[model samples]
Target: MPIPERFLDELMARTDIVDLVSESVRLTKKGSSYWGCCPFHSEKTPSFHVVPDRQIYKCFGCGKGGGAINFVMELENLSFWDAVSVLAKRAGMTMPESFGGSPDAQKRREKMLELNRRAALAFHRWLYAPEGAHGLDYLRRRGLSPGTLTRFGLGFAPDTWDALIQEMAKQGYDKRDLLDAGLAVSNKDGRIYDRFRNRVIFPIIDVRGGVIGFGGRVMDDSTPKYLNSPDTPVYNKSRNIFALNIAKKSKAGRVILTEGYMDTIALHQAGFDNAVASLGTSLTEEHAQLLSRYFKDAILSYDGDGAGIAAAQRAIPILEKAGLKVRVLRVTGAKDPDEFIKTHGRDAFARLLDKSENQVDYRLAQLQSKFDLTDDAQKVAFLQEAAQLIAARPSAVEREIYGGHAAQMAGITSESMAQEVSRALRHRLRKEKKQQERRDLAPAAQLQPKARSLRYDNIRSARAEEGVLRLLLLDPALLSRMDDLEGQEFSSPLLGRAFDALRGQAQQGLSPNLASLAQIFTGEEMDHLAQVASQPESAANGPRALTDYISIIRGEGLRRSQEQGDDLLLAMQKKYQKSKAYMEEKP
Candidate 1:
């Protein structure tokens, strides 16, 4: 059974939306609503708004809007019920005995987590067993002490199929559970086997200390050297980083972002506990936001290779957008941190980290390497590119400082470099203004759902539907005015479903707010509904406007039915004509 609607209503009533959101976002009052930068997506100017009266928050920039429950769900990356439970706890309310959302889904998530834990433990035990000698030797050779291995819960998968499969079976988990947990793989002909074999295992634990997934590295030269868990019910590789569970607790103020699990583990073993790595993927904006939560600064300690350089170049803007001070660690004399520390000692690596270059200088140096400054034309080209880069700096002061550096590198005057940067900035601003103008010209396009999957097929009917929803949500007393309308009449199925849900709540004498509808609506649906609610709807003219909206919706619905009927009739007539022609020819 799901939690009662009354319980959710009470929970939301006790939890203030502003108080919940203000903890993560720095909100300042502007008129009746509070505004702040959206934490869900990075932004410079504040576009996220919180309306205390409505008990909802919306980001005009990202189109993410919902009540308190949605805020917690998006900010913490939690499921709906989990988010509700968090608010319930904060409000000092006891949860109903029944689960909030789908019991089956919740059960499966818990089961997957348990299976992952059991698998992690089994792998750890196998590391010390005779079957894992080779894997153990590999880690030991990499300078991982037993204590460090234990600290990270590092393990080994034996060099045989069905080893983990058999172990999990004994632990009361079936092959299906193992597969769901990403601990086993299924091949053609219905054969099931372990996913990791003859490899060193790294358990990817969440910040909450749950074993969500695993990463394994082969002990020999293999075609695919590293293997990670596929996205499961409990794990998304893009949203998680290796060793962040421990790294978040480090006293060090900055995080050393590495490229692989081995590099992260090596850094941790060398006493830099604040190191983390992306899980077999390039650093993503989501990863940058996750890093920003714990640290004010991020040092990109990628491998000193072409791929590493390119990755750092791509990550600089993303990290900066997330409001983190970014630096690049130039690992000299070695290809990666693991090898660098092994060859030059930890002290030298620490010194290198201390002297890490800011992203501006690093990017400038990278640009300089692409051209021959001795050639006058190439020198001019280099300066042009450098000006564009420097112009992208958010601060005028930063642009000026970096412009001087670029001028020195190209042997040009600082004043000339500043002028070039100013021109580039003007060009960028004009491009942005033109794009904004295009968006303004198509105001209806801006009103469309941000997710393409939820687009409106009938703009005319959808506009009326939006008006009806906005009025009903803003004024629950207007529910009586919607007696002539039905949710199924709306042009968009998503909007129809929302209308039905909200109408049902209002009929039952419950407040038809986003919080009340959150349990029934998915996050995306809630976001769209919030967008509808955020639209301009005049309360003073609510009754008249609602009546007009309702009439328009019904009229549009009737017109659509007529059009569809005409099309069907035409199709039937064409078929009859063809059949008649065939009959005449046969006669």
Candidate 2:
């Protein structure tokens, strides 16, 4: 069996949704709902609303809506059960004993987490031990200090295969666990070896501070000098950040994003406490959203290599799209932060951070350096690309400022550049709109479907049942009145069952929580219920709204009765006659 509804009911009754969501959002009461700028996306105006009555939330801006459970699931990147456990812990409730999960799955997850923890400890221990002497020598060669090495949890993977595998097994870890953790690999000969060797290690942790995996930098010249943990049960490269666990603790909301672990440690050692890195991967939208929860701004500090500059350029729009105030830190005279910090003292690196340039200025500067303003054709090419990037800005004021900068850089009039920028923005918007339309029209396989819908229904009947259930979810007070309608004729069986379940719980002094309701539905049914529950309604205000909803359901029920006509009347009469005949025959 899945998690029992009764358990969820107790959990919700104990946990308050308003208190849970208010931690991340600056919610203010507006009419019947609490509205705030969505934490999930960038928007100046608030489109995220929390309805106290329904214990549900919706962001019109990003189209993300769900109950409190959904918010935690997305924000923390937790599975549904894990999210439920988090909330239950916060609410001081124990997870139900009847909750079902595959023991094999649990074992796999536990094994991976355990291996990562052990590997991190081993790496940290190696950083200071005699065996780590060579790794220590390598870091010093790279201009790292003892403080920097310890601070970043840098460790060494020995050159010999099976070193870590053997060490772990002696500590009681199994080969299967090591493989699942991405720390070990099996060869054709059926022998397992360490994934990283003769390398300095950097552990990758999730936002919640669990060690998910590691990234390694070779101590000497080698093919693919950097090695990282493959995607596994605990880590996804696109979704994890290297140093976010520590960086999020910084007083500054802004985070300095780098390309590698060394860059992150170097920046941090130089007093840029908010610096973090992607785990040897390109920037991703998941990373952007994750960062947005902690900060409002980002500074992209990529390497100065040709490939690095191109990667930064590619990432600019993605950061902007996520509504972050993005700036690019172009380090010159050195290839990366580690090198820059070494070549010049920490003060020089600090100066560079202080001089970070916005996207428009950075692009314009890069283009100005590339193309001759004296050459008309090159200037035009520069203007076209710069305009496309500048026009994507959400604020017109900022766009105009960048336009003026462009004019100054190209030796043209601000008015001309502004017109060009406007035209480019319109073109970009049209292109995006058309793309979105295509996305909407594409086959379901091409896109992740929004939860699937239940079969077509008589709109009126579905509406009535949906309204009653939604109201019941919002107001515990209305749960008592629902008992009167038990076993009554209902148009939607699922909706009826949901109602009866709530009423049954209410008689036992229980509250129906969103997670419990989730347990009641499966597949398409669950999707349909999520959509229905996420509906925005004004009737979410106080007891009167609940009463009004109950009235609407009753009215709809009566209307449905009238539509059945004389056949319905005949059936009732026949049932009554049969009951009387049965009594006479018994005597």
Candidate 3:
């Protein structure tokens, strides 16, 4: 069931759209509104605007506009109910009864959460038991303190087929609950068993302190040394970062992204509290988005091996796309952060973190590794790659700084390097421009509108109808005078559909704001509608302007119909003349 209208209104009122967005985006005050880079897409400049006066935000770059709750839903990847709950909690408001979310869904999620909590506790208990001594000793050998163990809910999954299964079953949870929580797995004969065993358990927690899932590492050398839970209804690994629950509270202004659980734990143990790792998966855009909510800068501390370098290469664009200032932490004389910290004390590691190179320099260094600069062909290849990287930098100052370094590395004059980079930059710009022109010329969208409420055959009526919709979106109260306008009257079906939705809302005495209307439209459609509303120009006289818009829409329809009639009449006249000529020939 949906939330009550009154409660939704109150929720939106309590939530400040600016505060909510500023958590992720860096907003700057401009006139009466706030502007920032669009979090939904990659752009060099700020286009996402928040108009506090209207209680709305719109990204002029990507066309995403909505209110506070809607923004939460989009940014956090939460459902409407979840977004509302987050806001309500922050606002210190109570949900009126079970108006918070669907009763069934809430109940199921609670059950799964309960099961996971119980399982995590059970694993923790087992770590100290006689059978779990091996895992406990392994933690000790890794230099993990007892306090750190408890802090992270570090435990041991017993090395038995039915250990967790029986333990959870004894706690009154059935096999179904275990499976639903991703705590146990079933085999071909329907024999349910533990999914994790003979491994030290690390609970993967969310920012809300919920044990969403678990990560387990083997006590000894094993084929699959590390294992993580599958995506469950309550836990999605793609959007989750291990240790983020604690990391977000750190005084450190930036987050250190590592490759694994042990590395993150080691960093935290060493007083570098702002450390997190992805759960047994490569870095994703969603991960970057999640990270951007906490910190402005991210120092990726992936291992210094080939795979680690490659991973960093892939992560740069994603992190940049998510609008995080990225730097790469390359460890020397050690395999990973854990080993590096262990070899050199916390002070040394901290110094290395402070001295970490930006991703551009890191990649250029990596590219330099591939070439023998003494060889002519290899040096040429090295310089070209360096030029491409240097050309992509938007700042001429940065280009010169990095260009000088590249020139020094290539043993060439800085002036020659500058010319090369500029040439590459111009060539790249031309290529991108041509590509944009091709894309603009092609109607590349695959969504074929099946109804007139989408698009239409007649261009003139579509344009006029779009104007009417644009007008209605800007001023919902204008819908009162639109009683005479049928949705079918608009030439473009999408405009008509939007008009009908607006009229319906006005009839119901509801506010047809972007957030509410978003409930009726898909994200894409909502963005399009919001784009229409974001247009600044409007009429001073409301009713007169609406009447004019309606007249234009209706007149275009009539004009197209008359044009069709003329075309039909011309066809008939030509047929009649041909018949007359045939008759004369017969005579």
Q: Which prediction has the highest TM-score against the true structure? A: 3
Work out the TM-score per prediction. 0.81, 0.83, 0.86
Task: Write down the lDDT that model 3 would get.
Answer: 0.79
**Model 2 — which ten-residue stretch has the worst lDDT?**
447-456
Which scores higher on TM-score, 2 or 3?
3
**Of candidates 2 and 1, the better by lDDT:** 1
Q: What is the lDDT of residue 321 in candidate 3?
A: 79
lDDT of 3 by residue, 233-340 (tens): 678888889999999998899999998999999999999999999988999877887887678899999987789889999998888877788999878999888888
Ranking by TM-score: 3, 2, 1
True-structure RMSD for candidate 3? 8.3
lDDT winner between candidates 2 and 3? 3
Supply the global lDDT for candidate 1.
0.85
- Candidate-wise lDDT, in order: 0.85, 0.73, 0.79
Clashes of each: 0, 1, 5
